[model samples]
Target: MRKHCCTPGQTTRTPSGTKRPSVTGSFPADPILPEMVSLAGGEFLMGSAEPHAYPLDGEGPVRTESVPPYAVAATTVTVAQFDLFVTATGYLTDAERFGDSLVFEAALPHDARAHPRVAETPWWAIVGGADWRHPAGPDAEVDAVRDLADHPVVHVSRTDAEAFCRWSGTALPSEAQWEFASRGGLSQQPYPWGYERDPGGEARMNIWRGEFPGAVSTPTGKTFTAPARSYPPNGFGLFNTTGNVWEWTTGVFDQRRRDHRAVIRGGSHLCHESYCRRYRTSARSGTTPDSSSGHIGFRVITAK
Candidate 1:
């Protein structure tokens, strides 16, 4: 078995001058392939100043941000959609090229072990053969998950997402654009719906329902990602903007950092208020460009 390791803050880098994968197929020019929702963008306050915010994340000192009118996909790029890209471009994802990706320990196979654990975040395991195709491990396939084709594609790196965007004639949303859309026309609201995390005593998004890294108490009975549109759309008709998977953004996560990390907004099903607490529109995290994990995915937007 091949072994690969990286520190908590570092990522496995692909060497320069590597040839691009050969194209095996192509996708038709269908303008309506990805249903997009038009947003009449305007100025809004960005970031957070809440007392509960994580200072190190730079989610404070909120400032006004403006976005031009644009159209964003109503939902994240799904596995089936990504598959179409892969088929058209024959593109090898970073996870595939690197031979591994990070997997949540909870999703690992029962007998799977002997993997490197991230020192700072032990919940993540570097499992060989863990890629978009095999999200959990070598033994697990994405098809095993019912309706996975409609679920947000995870285990994708920023580079992979960019390639998909380029192929589809779209671009990754900026941090401001992503936040603006996630808010669903609400200003400074903690969640997409409103101030309440679970309005009407019901789950409005996909997130950790009970204990973190252990017990799951979701009222929806879903321990992992729910299908796209499983939950109600935000006021803007965008789905799963706050939870399900962290969406990549074009904004730099930290200018002081040298690893070229980009901002990832929203949060995943692993997010828990007691732990990550990043499932809000204002929350943000940084990950290296080449990093691929089960919780990270992305959506695309086109300028109007």
Candidate 2:
């Protein structure tokens, strides 16, 4: 298993090599928007004090954090929603420009499994033709995205998310805002639903129930990304805030660096207790702005 399974970041060729398509001036007169959950944000304790928390990723030293009231989407941006943005803007994602992106070893087609894998993290394969539209690879399916329309759009970079925000008149949530909203009305609970991972023997969120890098599936036999609304909503009426897919945030992981990594909240279907146990409200990891993967996505936010 990868040493830092939850904080996987792949170094790719520079995105500046190819010219990006210019986005058109205006958004659609009537755009499809996600259901927004309004949060009257206040001071909330952020970070984990649990022994399982990762220290290098900065998941500890819980502190009092606050954010002004804001509205966030009830679900992560779905493939159907992202399709509308690409159709309107003609914008190419960083993955498309780079000609390849990372795919989970298990997610790749058996034939395509021979693709070059990432160093140190052998579970991640650098597959050509793998992007938001074709997460697994070109040969996996002809109309892969259309079939998974309701699933959270994966293989999107922070730049791609910001572009969508620009076109949709929305913004990515800050770390503070995301944490505040993710907590719902509860105080410092590991999960948005409550303390126990599964209460009453019912799975509250979609996460890996089996072994890491070897086996992965939800309780309902979901192998990959589940629908954005597959799970219950938190106290703030936000769905899948702690699992399904890691959502991008606007804040830099290390503000001191000129080229800083962006923070990603929530864990995905790949998260497991033995390895990547980041399926909680306060858990976070960082990756480059241009990094895109099959498990990474983003949601939009609006300030009140």
Candidate 3:
């Protein structure tokens, strides 16, 4: 079975192979920044040894990793936030440049589903015009940004995220920094909140309910990304850290592999217990630096 976090869609090996218009003007001096949570930073147990964890993804061995003080955005960057960065920089995301990206099959219109799908995971369709602006391809409404303003921006590549970080005077959190913050002070727990997937029988994060890839519906009636702040924060006051979208981090997936696949933390709304048990803090996956998909997004951080 394919690991849930292993959705790279069609990745262009070399980022330089897909360049677009150069960014205009200079970085905005006052780009809007997302709400950031300051972590006092300390040693925390990292990785998992649970039977359900994907050992091949390097999600185990349970070691202690320490991070210095840093501040992470409480939520993943939203559509509105990404729009502001693009508007300020005249930047084009790799998806926009490629003229297509991966879209979840369930989110596509019936006709769009006919598009070529990733052979490894048929759930992802290679969708034209599926950039952050047109999450559902050209079918997305003109006000898509406003409609998804509060939702985590999807279909953004790590390079796109780095551009946003550069413009916003921030940086993508390292895997250690992200895990420390997502753990929310919890020590080696399966989730940010605690051991229970849903403590008190309540959903603490936005993830696939029922089943995955084909459920087509959820208990909340949302088959797509939720508002960035839809759920309650963890103990450290981070929102949607485990689900909603996979967040890009600064670290590489593996040192041994020559592939420049960067690490992506958390899972997304597509995750389910039946498969893709990656909504936990320690869980991780990786994709090409230039790959973009509807379920991939990122947050930024600042060193203290």
Candidate 4:
């Protein structure tokens, strides 16, 4: 794995002649045709300066952060691609080694009991065989999962994600890279499409529609894990960059605070405005990089 060595307290380092991977160096671009977007190097706004932006989370105090141009993957790694990595490398995801993975308890059938689940979130249950292949626990089968091959793979940890990137000759995007790509060159809009909830009354991203955790049967779209290319691509030709799943970034959760969690950007389908409105592009949440959950997976990045 290519390591980026930098001391603590420093936010970023100057671009160097150190070798970096090309956008499509490892894999052929036929299946993953990512567009190379130009993020004109300059100082742009970061964080929300509007109401309901949640001031306490350190999301704001909109600051000017300048980032050099770079290339990023168009979408999260798909099941077919991730499967290829596992087959070639004989890789074992953290969840697979741990014997259990975090699954949303509400994802269970209506007849399921709520008491036997883990305590913190009654909706989160630790199922013994909930690895990427078995996302819904032991009984859930992928054979019936529509488009299982092309859908973005979930139930992967940072370690698992980084390993896959290494095998692919790519790297995880830094948190800055993720935010910049997600913005799609638009001014700090609340949502990826814009600062509106389906502004024209059309769903731009696939997120929790009805009540959160439970009752998430999408009126039209929510069967489960939409195809990796199901939605409209962003300005950078990135798909599902805002909602389907949370993508892990290389940045720390808080380079400022004492928080021990690593940063995970772009929310998951399980997030609801009522509970977790992390679906916004600039919005961020974190968890232990070592922690693997069903909604947590990542996309890869290559050096520009």
Candidate 5:
């Protein structure tokens, strides 16, 4: 099976050395709340050694990874938090600037018109007017789910994530920092919590509980993104580190590849054991820097 993050498709590669947007806005006067957890970084085996691991995705060999002490968000950035940034800076997200974004076909209305699909992943549709605010399409209103403001923000690109990081006075975690933190001080474990996906028949994460690209059987009744704290946190007090949404990291997908794709970790609500088993701590995928989709978001870290 071909390895894919979530929305798999070809993207126009950007030239190297393109300057990222400069940081703007004055720092918040009040100290941001202690929503971040400080980790005493150390060495741990990174990647997977399972026979079923996808070799092409480079999810194996179980090499040791070391990271310095740092702090990471206890949860992914939420819609409310992002909204504040937008309101303050009037920043336009990549999806907003592009006028559309990739949405999971399942999220659209049944009567929605057929949109162009990614050749490799037909479940993804290019929905016009789809962005962080209009997650489904033009007709959907974010106010409908205003109660879910604590849920992780979606339809954001690397550029948008970087901008958030800049404004927040934090930075995107490096791949090593992400993996090391996600491991939760565990060594060579498949997941952050433990060896089993669910310990004692309880779901530890918010991954697909049913057939992928079709039905959702999550007992929690959460079909798409759940509240950031929907499930129990890992050993490091981090929530949704394995699933919920694939998170952007500062690492490149592959140093050898010439494309501008960046590394994305965790999985998403769409991931299932039958296919797209990327919810493990070491599992990884990539997307173009400019690409934005409903299943991709990010977290930030502050180095100590």
Candidate 6:
């Protein structure tokens, strides 16, 4: 096995060449995912410094990785871009079509109380109106959500993300590629910048500031999604890669690793030390490709 993260049906080509991106369209549709820039892959370090060392369930064995060169998205996908894909492709996201999707209930407004969230984190709720277009639930308006043009799109299943990428002549990043790019030249830091963490003590990414499932209110009004570029980029010129939303990748998890779900990278801003500690450098998680939830979104990549 060559540390496979790829599945069949999608095309793959090395990103080492010098082919520029073709003109896609105008302002209304800014090349699908404007937050990302394709990176030329080579090789990099993978895995944690110790086995089962991470507080989360997925991290493990410190191992050296030598992934072949490839390109990856610079940031997670955004709503505006996904909306354009829906318009053009007539694609229905899993959440929208499923009639309901999982949400971190406590993350909702307190006045908008509904039911106790799910058990895993006590924040997930099966909200009927939560979808990519309406991230806050049905009757929610995207127009009122200002400056989120660059924020990562939410409630999109892996299928939804893949469809958009395919329509745009792109594809999801592989597990190896995603990690390599996310490292952004930093060798062994939790964040792309280095182990020191957000300079001046600012929240490095958009993860929950106060608490996990039980709490949502934060000093920055951090209950919900923030702008895509709300934080600065990592050492590799990538932004919002760590904490905004979990990003989908093209790799399969179980075969290469022992995880049960499909692989996703760049822990979301929803990450918390007490709850989901996946914000670290070596963390990894999984879900069915067709399963769509509010916490998941994705970016894109193309061959050079």
**Deviating ranges (above 4 Å) for candidate 5:** 9-22, 26-34, 141-145, 219-223
In candidate 2, the residue pairs with backbone N, CA or C atoms under 3 Å apart (3 or more residues apart, or in different chains) clash, namely none
Over 4 Å off in model 3, which ranges? Answer: 1-6, 12-32, 219-223
Local accuracy of candidate 4 as per-residue lDDT tens digits, 192-293: 667885877888776778865556554324336676776777766778887777898987766676756678888877766766777787777767666766
How does each model score on lDDT? 0.79, 0.82, 0.81, 0.67, 0.80, 0.62
Query: What is the alpha-carbon lDDT of model 3 when measured against the actual structure?
Result: 0.81
The Cα RMSD in angstroms, rounded to one decimal, for candidate 3 relative to the true structure is 2.5
Model 1: pairs clashing at backbone N, Cα or C within 3 Å? none
In TM-score terms, candidate 2 sits at: 0.93
lDDT per residue, candidate 1, 1-304, as tens digits? Answer: 1111111333654444446674333347664257899999999999888765676787888999999999999999888788778767778888888777888777776678778988868878988888776778777644523447777888898889888888788899999999999999998888999888988898888887777667555433432777777789999999999888889899887898777677888888877777678889898888787888887889999999
- TM-score against native, each model: 0.90, 0.93, 0.92, 0.83, 0.91, 0.80
Give the alpha carbon lDDT tens digit for every residue of 1-304 in model 2. Answer: 2255755676647654777676645446554558887878888888888766777677778999878988899999999888888887788998999888888887776677689877777888888889988988886862445778888999999989998998787899998888888888888789997788889989888788876667545653423888888877888888899888999998787778676889999998888898788888888888888898988999889989
RMSD of each: 4.5, 2.2, 2.5, 8.6, 3.3, 8.6
What candidate 1 gets wrong by more than 4 Å, as runs, is 1-10, 13-18, 22-32, 141-147, 216-223
Q: Point out where model 2 deviates above 4 Å.
A: 24-31, 219-223, 256-259
Which residue runs of candidate 4 sit more than 4 Å off their true CA positions?
A: 1-41, 109-116, 143-147, 219-223, 255-259
Clashing pairs in 5: none
**Model 6 misplacement above 4 A:** 1-38, 50-52, 55-58, 109-112, 115-117, 139-147, 218-223, 256-260
Best first by lDDT, ranked:
2, 3, 5, 1, 4, 6
Give model 5's TM-score versus the native structure: 0.91
- Quality of model 1 by C-alpha lDDT: 0.79
Report the lDDT tens digits of candidate 5 across residue range 6-111: 8564374232433434567644654332289999998888888786567788887788888888999988988878877787788788877777788888778767
For model 1 the TM-score comes to 0.90
Return model 1's CA RMSD, one decimal.
4.5
